[model samples]
Target: MLRRTAPCTQAPTTGTVLAGSLWHEAADPVTRRPGGPYGPLREPDVNGVALPEGFTSRIVARTGRRIGGVLWHPAPDGGACFPDGDGWIYVSNSEAPLLGGASAIRFGPGGAVVDAYRVLSGTNLNRAGGRTPWNSWLSCEEILRGRVFECDPYGSRAAMPRLAMGRFRHEAVSCDPDRGVVYLTEDEPDGCFYRFRPAYWGDLTSGVLEVLCATSDRGPVTWRRVPDPGGARAATRDQVGDAKHFSGGRGCHYADGLCLFATGGDDRVWAYDAERERLEVAYDAGAPPAAAEAVTPSGDLYVTRDGGDMEIDLITPDRVVTPVLRISGHPGSEITGPALSPGGDRLYFSSKRGPRGDASGTDGVTYEVTGPFRR
Candidate 1:
C-alpha cells in the first residue's frame, strides 16, 4: 500500500462522492517497448536477481540473520515504507504461524540501515496491510476469524486490534484519506471487497464496516453495513444480502480517484471508481497471477506474482505489461512486499521461502532494487 502523510485539503462527504477526484491520468509521452520502460534484463546479479540495465540489486536482510541487534523475522510478507526524520522506516510482516508478527528496519538519509526492531507481536499470519494518512501501519491477518491490527511505525504505541474492520481472512488494505475510510480485501475463494468507514478521520477505534453491493460485474455499486463485523455467528462476507464476491482478493491499492485490486483465482485486476461508483476490469488476461501491488508517484502500477517464476511485473499507465525484475534459482519461493523507498528510487521486496524453498518459510530473503524509476 502507498503511504501519504499529507492531509486532504477538502474532505469529501463520502467515498463515492469524492472518488472521481483521485483518478489520475499520465500525460508524458511514453516510448512503447516490448520488454519494459527500462529495457530487457541483463544477466543475473550476485544476489541472483535479473534486472534491466542501469538498475542494480542488493540484499538487505535474510531470515534468522542479525540486523541492528535483533534477529530478522522469517517469511517477510507485505510491507510499506514510511518517511522518518532523515531517512525512512520499512516494516515487514512475518507469515509464520504462531510466530507471525511484524518487524521494522530504519534507514539513514543515505539509505543505510540504522535500526531494526519489532513492532507487532503475538499475532497469527500477519499477511499484508496498508499505510494510514496518520503515519501508522495496519497489519492484517490472513486466517479464519482473523482481525486487523493497527501498529505504530515508530514502535512507540502498542498494536491495537480494530474489531470494527470485520473478522475474516484478510489479504491487504488501502486507505482513502479523503473519505476517512479504509478498503480491505480477503483471500478466500468467495471473498468480498469491503470498506471500513471510521467514526472520525484519522481514527479507527469505532467504525461501520461495509461490503460492496452491486447487481453486476461492472457496477454502479453501493455500500451495505456488515451487521456483524465481529463474525460472532456468521462471517462478515455472508452477512450482506447481495454482497459481490471477489475470487481471491489481494494487493489492494488506492490512489487519486481509483482503487485497484487483483484476484489471483480469476486472474483479473479490478478497478473501482469511487466518485462514479462504477466497477471495471482493468487487466483481465495475459499477465502473471497478481498478489501484492504498489503504485509509483507517476501512477504506474507494480504487481508481484503469487508463485509463478518469482517475478515482479510492471504495468504502465498505458496498459503495457512487462517484468521489471525476476528472481533466479528460487524455484518455490514467491515475491512479496513490492514497496518503493521514500525517494521512489529503490524497490524493496522479499522471496517468501527463499533458497530452502520449503513450506516452513525459514529462509526468506529481502532485497532492494535501485533504478531510474518513473517518478
Candidate 2:
C-alpha cells in the first residue's frame, strides 16, 4: 500500500543560496503499489550530480496523484514562464498521455490544483508556448492537425485556431510582442521557421505567414507561405526548400530590439537582428533541434535533446553551455518539460514513466530542482 500526506504547504520558496537547499519534505522514496498510482516525492537524490554546494533537488510533483493542485498524467512535455507581478507565472505543456486524454490546468491566481474549467479547455498534445507582452497564452498543439489557440490570462481565451499562423506540427513559438510578430517552429525532421505579424498589433489571427531562407549572411530572406502539406510532406518540404523566396524556416526567437533566434534541427542556433535584418550564428551545440529557451532577467538559455542524455543545460552570455543536471536516458528518465521560476531558483521538468510492465517504470513525473541558479 502507498500513502502521501496532503502537501504540507505550497512548495517552499527560498532566497538565493549557493549549493542550494532541498525541500525538507523530500528524503523518502515515493512508491506505488499494484492497481495504485505513484506517490509524492520522497528519498529523492541528485543521482550522480551533487549539489554545487548549497543547491539541492526536490520532487515537486509526481505522476498519477494530485500534484501542484492538479492530477498529473503520464508525462509532462513543454513549459513556459510568465511574470506574475512580483511573482512568476508557471505553466506546463501536459502532452498526450500514453493512456490518452486532454486536461487543462492553470496556476498562481489561486492555488496549484487543476479544476475542471473552461478557461482553456479540451485539447491534447499540448507542447510549449511563448510569453506575450500583453500577458496571454499562445498554447500550441503537437498533433498533425493541431491548432494554435490564444489563451488570455485575464478573461476568456480566444478559442479559434489562428490559421494565419500556418498549419504544420507546431512545436514552439517566440513572440515579439512589441512589434506584434510571432515567430514559430514546426517539428518536421527539417522543420521551417514561420513569422506572423498581426494586421494590427496584438491581434494574432490576422497576419502574414512567411517562411525564411537564411542568407549567406545572417539575414533571412522571406519566402511567403507556399503550401501546407497536401498529402506530400516531403514534397511540401521541397517546395519550401527550392522556392526562390525560400528562407526563414528555421526555428527563431524575437526579443528586445527584435533579435530573432532560430535553429535548423542541425543543432545550430542563429541570432538575427530583425531591425538590421542581419543574421549571425548564435551557438552550435551540434545535432538537430536548435530547440532551446532563453530565461529572462538572467538571459540564460536551456537547450533540450540534441542527441544526448535528456539533460538540462544552461547557456551563458559568453557562449558557454553548462550542465545543471541530467536525468538518465533510460525510459523513465528522459527529460522533456522544463520551466524556470521567477527567481530562477527552481526548475520544473517532466518525463514519461516506464510502461505498466516495464522494469524501470513510471507514469510520467514532474520534478522541482531547487537551490541557487546562476547565469
Candidate 3:
C-alpha cells in the first residue's frame, strides 16, 4: 500500500538560490579569485580522457566485450554507483536496440572490476537512470513507449516495470526518499517535467503521474495529471493541458530537498522546490546541458555539456562553475552518467560513442576518476 507523509518542510538552501543566480551572470567568474579548489585540467596520460590536477582516471569497462556470459552491451549511457559489501557496484545503461538494458560492474576495494554481468535486459534505449536511497536502480528508457524499470543492482531479482510512472520518452529520474516522491524528465523538444507521488514510499508499483505547469523560471509551480498513462494514442505531453515545456529534457538528480534537472535543448539546469512549489533555473550554460548529477548531502552539482568539447562542469556549494574533466578526441560524443561512489571519493561517467564520433561503430566507454573531491 502507498504511504503518505507530511509535505516537505525544508526551505531552499542558500546555496541553491546562489547557484541559480550564476545562470544569468558570467560563467565561472570566481575562477579568477584566489585559492579555489579547482585547478587547470590536465591532458590525461591515458588515451581518450582528461582530468584536473591531482585526479587520475582509468577505463573500467567498454562496449562490445563479453563478460560473465553476456556481451557487454553497447552505447553505455547513464549509470549509478552502489555499495556492495566492502566494495562497490556500478550499474550502467545500454542504449542499444534489442540489447538495451543495464549492466553491472562490481569494483573491489582497490577499484578493480571484480566481476561484471548483465543485470537487466530486453528493454529499449536505456539511456540514463538514478539509484534510489532505498536500494534500487530506476532505469529509464528513452523511447516513445519507454517505461521506467526498477532493477536490483545486486541481481537478486529481475527488473520490473513501473507502468504507473507513465509511458513516455523518459530520460532520467531522481527520487526524494523523505517524501516518497520521484521526479522524471522527458527527452522531447517539448518534454514536460514530472513527479510521481508513489502510493507507498519507495514503492513505485503504483503512483499518480503529474506534470508541472510553470509560466516562468521563478515559478509558483502546479501539477496536472497525464490523461493517458499508456502510449496507446496521444502522448502524456499532448494530453496534459498547460504543462510546462522543457527543451530536450535530460538528466535529473535530487539533493538537499530539491530536484535538479537539465534541458539539453535550452542549455539550462533547473531546480524544483517541492516544498515551496517553485521551479527556477539553477544554471544556464548557453549550450545544452547533457546531464545533471548531484553529490548527495553536500548539494554540489556536476553537469555535462551536450556537445562541443564535452566537458564535465562542477558547481560548488558556493555556486562556482568549473570544468573538472574534458572528453576530447570524440567530436560527437558527450560525457554522461556522472555518478559518485557511495563514499564520494570516486567519480564515474561514460563517453557515449566512445573516443571516436558516433559513427565509429564502437558503442561507448565508461571511466572512473578518483581524487580529493570536496564533500
* TM-score winner: 1
- Give candidate 1 misplaced runs (Cα > 4 Å): 1-34
How far residue 231's Cα lies from its native spot in candidate 1, in Å, is 0.3
lDDT of all predictions: 0.78, 0.48, 0.72
Q: For candidate 3, lDDT tens digit of each residue in 203-234?
A: 88997888999788776889988777776898
Tell me each candidate's TM-score: 0.91, 0.69, 0.88
* All candidates in order of lDDT, best leading: 1, 3, 2
Q: Per-residue alpha-carbon lDDT of model 1 for 1-375, expressed as tens digits?
A: 222211111111111121322332222222334477889987899999999999999999998999985688889998888778768888899998988989999888888999999999999998878777677888999999898999997899999999889899998888887677899998899999999999997889898999999988775899999999999999888998899998888777776667877787877767788878788775565544556455664556676765557877776656566778889988889888777777678888899899779787889999989898876
lDDT, residue 211, candidate 2: 67
Clashes of each: 5, 32, 3
TM-score of 2: 0.69
Clashes of 2: 32
Q: Model 1: which residue pairs collide?
A: 19-275, 22-256, 22-257, 23-256, 23-257
Worst 10 residues of 3 by lDDT: 1-10
TM-score winner between candidates 1 and 3: 1
Range of the 10 consecutive residues with the lowest summed lDDT in candidate 2: 1-10
